[model samples]
Target: MFRWYQRAQVCYVYLSDVSSSVLEGDSPTSLRRKPAIRKSKWFTRGWTLQELIALARVEFFSKEWNSLGDKQSVLLTLHERTGIAVRALEGSPMTIFTIEERMLWAKGRETTREEDAAYSLLDIFDIYMPLIYSKR
Candidate 1:
């Protein structure tokens, strides 16, 4: 999936848990409420981290499918929301950053399945571990 993301022409991120109908207007109210976009659920998911980093160009959409912005347009917000280096968001090779820094990217992300937390990171570290659905 990580490799597929890297080779994709573009990835469209649908923020299903966020509504942009109120923020999409051109009025001053809407413009001032741009910060609302940062509260999207995508930022808290473990799997989306890989998708965000691997995809060269990501076009973000709201639950209503409203065009929020592309990766470049929201780079600063993405950095502030995720604490990911702007260079990484800009497609820098993962090897250039230390393992600690790379691991920090998934610091607060959550996975629904117990083993998924471990699974979510395999690609980021270039490891191939067999799936182990532990009962713990």
Candidate 2:
């Protein structure tokens, strides 16, 4: 999956109320009052980290499919929301960052299966281990 993301030209299209409000006359505060991007299920998923890091390009769209901007325009908000460094969001190689650093970035993100919290990172960390379903 990580390899596919690296090789493929990926664009993330979000049906965002925030992007729509920004397009309209509403202030970011008004958008904030609605559901935040931070609270999004995509951001909280463990597997999403790899996709975010591996993809070189991403696009944001309004509910109506109007282009808001590229991912670069909102790095600060993404950093603030997800605890991910702007450098990471700006296409820095994940290899330059330490495992501990990556783990810290993932602190609050969750997975329905507890093991997936670690397993999702296997490719990001360039490590391989048997997926042991049993905790013991």
Best by TM-score: 1
For candidate 1, lDDT tens digit of each residue in 13-102?
888877876674667643533476688878998888888889889998888888888888888888889988888889888888889998
Query: How would you encode candidate 2's per-residue C-alpha lDDT over 20-85 as one tens digit per residue?
Result: 544455466434423444444567778777767777787666666665555666567667777777
Off by over 4 Å in 2: 15-23, 26-39, 129-136
In terms of lDDT, the poorest run of 10 residues in model 1 is 24-33
RMSD (CA, Å), each prediction: 2.5, 4.3
Decoy 1 TM-score against native: 0.86
What do the candidate models score in CA lDDT, each in turn?
Answer: 0.83, 0.69
| Regions more than 4 Å wrong, model 1 | 24-34, 132-136
